[model samples]
Target: MKKYISLFLLSSILVITSCDERFEELNTDPNRPGGSVFDPNLLLPTATFQHGDLITGYSGPILFQSMWIQALASTSTGGANYYSNADKYVASPSTPNYIEGNWNVGFSLSSRLNQMQILAQQRGLNNLNAVGQIMKVSALSVVADTYGDIPYSEALQAQQGISQPKYDSQADVYNKMLSDLEAALNSLSASGDQLRNDVMYRGDITKWRKFGYSLMLKLGLRLTKVNASGAQSWVQKAVAGGVFTSADDDALVPSDEANGYSNSSANALNVPDDIYEVRWSKLMIDYLKNTNDPRLRIVAEVPPAGLAANRNGLVVGNNDPAVQIGLPNGFDLRGGSFDISNHPNFPGATGSGGDVAIIGAYSRPTAIYRRRNAPVFLLTYAEVQLLLADAAVRGFVPGSAADFYRQGVLGAFTSMAKFGGETVSASAATAYINANPLNVSSANASLKMINEQIWATTSLFANFLEAWNNWKRTGFPELTPVNFPGNFSSGQIPRRQPYPAGESSTNGESLRAAVTRMGGDNWITRTWWDGGN
Candidate 1:
């Protein structure tokens, strides 16, 4: 009995000693850095890369906005029927999956950025915190813009025990985004720690400031339809704070293809189905052709003879302007009434018999766009210049709308060379600008011309979502909505995408409240910034 009690006491003493002295030491992970030691700079690259991927991805932009804005069109029949979600405004089996993309990815990234901000603040890393703020807004803006009323103020607070974030109004979201952006832009200091993991600007704080301001300009312009005075105020603020002055200042994040990170846009375009079916829209090509835009040949190509070659992703096509014809939207390959063969003024298919190339004559995007390592352009100097042009026309800023327009045109032409294609000569670009000068005869005419250029520029750059968003805001280059049978929007263009179906199950009450506030959770419902009450 005495021996047993002694043994038990010895074990108990050992455990008590271990708990008091070595418990926390053993629990501490030697490999992991604590909050103070971990560098917040590491978070910026992740947010940057993921955002680049999100925008350029197959689901978010490619399957929806790319066709919605008539930048690219596909025959939604047979092997390519999945494209009906985009081209025909019709749902596919995977439509629910696609709808969840922006909400799921965007909020998750915003949460990561918010985490970075918290850590940076704890460590007194002001520059990193500022970058985090800007990036968080960028991520959240995509969600808010796409779905209308998204969880903004209470979003990304899962760590704070708020699992179901209440959706904020789009107007409130925009106001908060603008305020956050302004504060962040003003906080950037060149003297701070070098951003070791920055993939966008290589730790160039000045360029980051420019990017923030440019984004602010865009967000401000979105309010033009709803609050013109607010738009003017923010536009002036952006200009005064400085904006992208050159192509070099454009925000681009290159895909880490060598590390197995494929450029999603390029990956999607290179897919057999997309490559075989997707082509430049007639709406897009007609405007480019009518203006004799220098980019028409450089950005488009007609595939070689036969179905095999057309479907062959390796074959570079003829880029001659005369050979480039755009495919009409809402057509199909079912060989029925809606077939491309039956369409008016059909530019006959290329091959015959079993090797027939149905869409061979229509202009497909150039091979440069399919390169796996292609840089994702976030925002560019061309867009900034053009937006400034619009502001100028509206008397929101002091400048010649024509000069700003000219700069925008020139910037766009210069930026096109980044695709590793034939460069439009500076002289040729200048000539085009001079030939198609901004229609300064009246404010409306000038606004129309400026925004039309914006549409064209964004389209050619493959920034399809921005193109669609701008169209919604400005109503320029008025697109003819395809009234396909059984479209979700009753022949009207979709104003906003529906919230993901899962929200109804997971965040049911909040989702219901937002749906009610937004009038209804459907495609035709306009957002608050889109002039909806």
Candidate 2:
């Protein structure tokens, strides 16, 4: 009994001695620096790369927007068809998956950016904070554009105990984005240590400023229909702040061959069998061919053995500018008269030797675009130039709209060559611009011509969402609506995607209110900036 009591006393003493007040300090992980506080540099690349991927990735642009804009078409039938309903203006269950994916990506990336901003402010890392702010706005802008109202002010505030954030109006979101961009620009400086992981611009503070201002230009133009005075003010402000002046200042994210990090369009269009299913749409091909645009050869290619024998080392039909054929939208294999043998350029002998009218015979994306490492263009100088041309037409900026228009066309051609792995000579670009000068006789005609050129230029980058947005704003290109039976929106093209269905359960009240405010969460509901055109 005495021995047991002595042992118990010794154990109690040991426990008491081990109980230090700084227990957490003693156990602190040496591996983790500044626990729970991440370096802003580390977070910058993640936010930029993920934001770029989300915007240019499969779910956001390639799958829906590209098809809607008639840049690409679905050739598969039944279960294998991914964009059948989307191409035909019919709703499908998979759409919400895409919506949710985009929503999650935007918010998830912004959450990290929010953390980085807070940490940077604490550390007096002003430039890093500015980068984070710009990225946050960029990520959220996609969300707001995609779904009208979204949680903005109250978003990324879970640590403050606000679990369910309220959705801000689209107008409010845009206003906030513009204000945030301006704040970021003001905070940025070349004096400080730049972000080490700045993947887009590689720590070039001037380019970052230009990127922010370019975003301002885009957002400002977005308000043209709804707020002309506001648009003019912001456009002028952006130009004064120094927008992208050349292709060298284009904001592009270099992609690797990895699955998630690879180019989104290439991922969708470069597969062995899947590549055959996707081809240039009739809208894009016909427009390029009719206009005698030099970009057509760079953007598209004929299938193997689809044309006559090789001539002068050229791949015959594949390389010949005249032999390209685009498959019509809203058609399956049987629906489209895809019999290559019946094609006028078919070089097969009589009926016995012709190539089958299948996926291989149609014009597909160019080889350069299918490469694994093709860079993803986030925003380009050409787009800014085109916007400037529009602003000039509105008399919002001082410049010849025709000259800006020509510059925009040239910029687009130059930028596209980087992706197509083709060399478009300056002379060729100049010749094309000379041939297709902007018609400036009437304001209406000039605006229409500029917007039409915007459409064509945007298609080269597969910038479908922006193209659709511009089409909605200016009503140019006059795309024929798909009239498939049982189609949603009465055979009209979708104006917006429906909110993710999961939002109904997780954020029901907020989601319901947003839907009510937007006048219903269907595809045809015009967003705040849409102006109901």
TM-score of 2: 0.87
Q: lDDT (CA) for every model shown?
A: 0.82, 0.73
lDDT for predicted candidate 1 compared with the true structure: 0.82
The runs of at least 3 residues in candidate 2 whose Cα sits more than 4 Å from the true structure, single-residue gaps closed, are: 1-31, 35-38, 91-93, 258-260, 305-317, 334-360
As a whole number from 0 to 100, the lDDT of residue 434 in candidate 1 is: 82
Candidate topping lDDT? 1
Clashing pairs in 2: none
Lowest summed lDDT across 10 adjacent residues in model 2 is found at: 1-10
* Predicted candidate 1 versus true structure: per-residue lDDT over 1-533, tens digit per residue: 11111222233333322222232343355754545666666666656767876677665788888888888898875233677877889877778788888788787677667766776888888888998898888878888888999888888766567889898999999999999899998889999866666777878899999999999999998999889999999998999999999999988766666555567888888887788878999888888988889999898998898998787778989988877788899898777787888988788878988999876488899887888777787889999999999998888899998999999999999998877678999889988988898888899999898888898898888888888888888888778898777788888888788999989998999999999998999988988988633
State every prediction's TM-score relative to the real structure: 0.93, 0.87
